[model samples]
Each structure stands twice: as C-alpha cells, then as structure tokens.
Target: MNVDLDTAKEGLAVLQQYGGQAAAAAGSLLAGLASPFQLFEGGWGLNLLFFGVLGLLAYSLVVLAPRQ
Candidate 1:
C-alpha cells in the first residue's frame, strides 16, 4: 500500500520522539542502578527504594488521573 508523504513523515516523527523518550528513561534507570553509591551517595538499597517510590508515583498518577 502506498502511504501519503505527509502521513509517513508524521509517523516517523512520532516514532523518533517515542524512541528518544525510551532511551532517556533507560539511561536514568541504568544510572540509578549502575552507581547506587553515586546516586545521592547512598547505598544500593536506598537507591532501589527511590526507584520504587518513583514508580509508584507514576503508577498512581496514571491510574488515578481524571479521565477526560
């Protein structure tokens, strides 16, 4: 099937934006995991706990956000 040029470009733009976001998230997670001591200069346990809390916040925001 032949796709319109503008439609194809829009699709590519969306894909690139999503990829960049994913990469940034992965990098942050890796940074937190790779250097627990360096992450806020605390131990791995604390670092993990921080990530857990962060995840919970995001989860709650998604699940509890008012639907449009």
Candidate 2:
C-alpha cells in the first residue's frame, strides 16, 4: 500500500472540521438545557406539559399491554 502524507493531512483536516461541528452542536444543546430558570421564566411551561403528556402515554401503554 502506497501511503501519501498529503492524503493523511487531508483526512486529518476533515476530521477536525467534523469534530468542531459536533462540538458546536453539543455546546448549543448544553447551553439550552443549562438555564432552566430562564427557560421557565420565558414561557417554557410547554416543555413540562409535553413531559407530562409523555408520562401519561407511557402509563397508558403499560396498563393496556397484555401481560404474559
């Protein structure tokens, strides 16, 4: 196998770019979740409402599923 330095460098650049993008996305997600007080103050009750709905749906599924 003929390995070239330029190809390796290009691969590393591509990897760095992907890592940067992933890091940015993760940072945004963390920032969004970190300020719960601000979120709730800013009319984020819908988040909790959605969670409540999800819990009810899960409970209903468990109750309605056939037991072995």
lDDT (CA) for every model shown?
0.83, 0.80
- Estimated TM-score for each candidate: 0.53, 0.50
Model 1 per-residue lDDT tens digits across residues 1-68: 99999999999999999999999999999977776345666466777788889899998788767553
lDDT per residue for candidate 2 within 4-56, as digits (tens), equals 99999999999999999999999999878866634345565876786688889
**Candidate 2 vs. true structure, TM-score:** 0.50
Q: Which stretches of candidate 2 lie over 4 Å from their true place?
A: 38-68
lDDT of 2 at 19: 100
Judged by whole-model lDDT over C-alpha atoms, candidate 2 comes out at: 0.80
Best by lDDT: 1
Q: After superposition, how far is residue 27 of candidate 2 from its true place, in Å?
A: 0.5
Candidate 1 global TM-score = 0.53
lDDT of 2 at 54: 82
> Which ten contiguous residues of candidate 1 have the minimum total lDDT?
35-44
